[model samples]
Target chain A: MKVNKYITIYKDMVRQIESGQRKAEDVLPSENDLCDQYGTSRETVRKALNMLAQNGYIQKIKGKGSVILDREKMRFPVSGLISFKELSETLGKETRTTVHRLGLILPPSEAAKELGTEADEKVWEVVRSRRIDGEHIILDKDYFVKKHVPLLTKAICEDSIYEYLEGELGLSISYAQKEIVVEPAGEEDRKYLDLGGFSHMAVVKNRVFLEDTSLFQYTESRHRLDKFRFVDFARREK
Target chain B: MKVNKYITIYKDMVRQIESGQRKAEDVLPSENDLCDQYGTSRETVRKALNMLAQNGYIQKIKGKGSVILDREKMRFPVSGLISFKELSETLGKETRTTVHRLGLILPPSEAAKELGTEADEKVWEVVRSRRIDGEHIILDKDYFVKKHVPLLTKAICEDSIYEYLEGELGLSISYAQKEIVVEPAGEEDRKYLDLGGFSHMAVVKNRVFLEDTSLFQYTESRHRLDKFRFVDFARREK
Candidate 1:
């Protein structure tokens, strides 16, 4: 498949922004200037700028061009189903993953229903916590259907399960449905995360599917309230 | 511009889901059945179904076909910028909107910076709360630029401000940037919303813009922790 020219431009500009070469609050060059510099049409330049705005890299001011937003404080794209290893590498942060439990078991009825599993079917359960800068801010509890992921181990859970699934197993993740809400911290959250006396936590529940339209995984990620933030760029539907 | 044939199918199905005509857990007709019913091709029906899946209206299980999710329990779509009046009507509930405060005033410096307002300029501040079945569940604080909306009235505030803006003023709302976080409920939240002794609230901060690509409004919507839920459909980036 041939990639669009505008996507190439978008990736190049985003790479500059993420690598600290383009500092926050720095104003991007005018569209005319960018088109001239990149040797692309004005429409292509606008497409790249729109992608930048949609991904939360910059804010477009009316007359001032696109100004880089301060993504330094909390720069995680919760919109996509990205693994912790991929995310930490993107941010260039020292992150550690610890697997508390890894085994096959009968999933909860709710999880089973969401994962489209039968009554007797078993699924792989993985409980892990992610530590970024020495704080266990995220606790992830995941259940994968045995049909999709037949094998699981503690070592893979501690490393990257997504890598094993996508790279080694050659499975393609298509899309996911996610729900975000705030709830009182459960016992498991307190046990795994450093809550800092916070009684509430932000919970993201996800139902992941494969390219062939099969439900593969059900996950619940609990984040300490003070450490949780979700940013989204949305266009009004026509 | 011509709209795609599949989009027409998508909108019709979405209307059915929103109106409660299509009940939750109801499995939609098979692609072949839908194609025969709508006089369209299988590809067109699949496209409509895919749109439904992307917008959180349905979930497609591999063997079970597409099953409508229970959207009645929590139906407000915080994923996109939607007015309360438009949302409540879709839910078909006896919703009431009360204006707590409405006037022109000097916005806070932070809000001014986000809205790109002059230091000496004034903005319209409207504070309102939403009640569903006599339970106040939401509180909204909005600041609009005076230049964009030159007229404001208490009647319009109590009614639908979005309607007045789009219909009467012919203003076009294009997009918004939103951030969601959980914060300890303040006195205002406790007083305005029936929080039921919950200490935490979900705060959605929004910056809205018009079709001309100019920032026009800054809003903060506070919801009772138990009453808040955000659903989103996300596609993975390859």
Candidate 2:
């Protein structure tokens, strides 16, 4: 498959930033210089720079060129359907997942509504807590339509259910609709997470659909307020 | 100006949903049926349907077509650079903005860092509270680089600064990078907003840029937890 030239440039720049070759507040080369260096047009270099800016890698200054942004907090992309395992891998930090509970039970009212399950339909409920550097910061509650998922185990929940669902079960995971809201920490959150002095948590509600567009899973990820940060790049709508 | 057929279809569907012509859980016409009704190809119809699904208007099921989604909470788009005035107008809600404070002063340490201001640089600080149906739900703290803005008034602050900046100042608002996090409600938040019993708030920190790619403004919008909702549609990146 042929990749776009601008994407290649974007990836190389990201590598440089991530590898510490490009430090924060460092201004990038001029567009003309980049164009000549990459043997690409000015438009192409700008495209790459735009992508960098959009992803929070750089800030474009009017006359000073693009400056690298300080990336202290882990950036959770607001527009990606990434799994916790994938996210942990990308962070390259010491992470562990603890499966608190795994069971096949009648769907809760809210989960039933979200999954569109009929009466007497069962769903797989999985609860897990994520620990990074000995700090428990995230509590995930997941429900899967038993009719679609069929079977789930604690071991699978400990790993990545998405990997099993897609690789083993041959399910074509497609798109998702996500809603983020701040809510008071519930009793379950207190039990599964290290709340410390925080009284509220950021809740990310996600409904995942298969390629055929069937809603198969509903997940609520609760994160400790201080540990949660979502970054988004937005273009002005004309 | 020529609008894409799919966008026209998408807008029409949004109007139908908003006007109550289409009810929640109501199944939309099948792709082939929509193609025939709109005199378009299946691909075009699918694009329109996709947009509808993406915007939380509908959910597509494997064999049952698309079903309208419940829109009880106001859906806040996560990837748009819209002003509060524009959002309230779209919501058609009784909203009021109270300018609690507006002044030009030396930039605050955090604001200075975010705006990339040098020493001795001044910024216009505007603090406003948003009332929806007589309940104070949002508090906005905005800092604008005085060099670019030049002037600001209480009237402009109470109204829409973006409007004044664009319409009067002829500034081209371009893009923004946003960070959403939950934080403990500060003293200012407790004083300005109707917190009820909640002790935390959702903070949306935005750094806005102009068409020239210069960062000119930094805004921190604090919202009551119950009143905050952000919706995003994301596709899986392969």
Candidate No. with top lDDT? 2
Per-candidate local distance difference test:
0.82, 0.83
Residue B1 lDDT, candidate 1, scale 0-100: 79
| Predicted model with the maximum TM-score | 1
User: Per-residue CA lDDT of candidate 1, range B131-229, in tens?
Assistant: 988899898988999989998998998899999999999998877777898878887777788888788888888888776566799998898988888
How do the residues A122-223 of candidate 2 rate in per-residue lDDT, one tens digit apiece?
988888999989999999999999889998988899999999998899988877778898788898889888899888889899988776667789999999
Candidate 2 segments exceeding 4 Å error: A1-74, A108-110, B1-74, B108-110
Give per-residue CA lDDT, model 2, range B27-65, as digits (tens).
898999989988999978887897677556787888778
lDDT of 2 at B216: 94
C-alpha DockQ for predicted model 1: 0.46
Candidate 1, which segments miss by more than 4 Å at Cα? A1-74, A109-113, B1-74, B109-113
Model 2 TM: 0.78
The DockQ scores of all candidates, in the order shown, are 0.46, 0.49
DockQ of 2: 0.49
- Give the Å shift of residue A213 in candidate 2: 2.1
Give every collision pair in model 2: none
The CA-based lDDT of model 1 is what?
A: 0.82
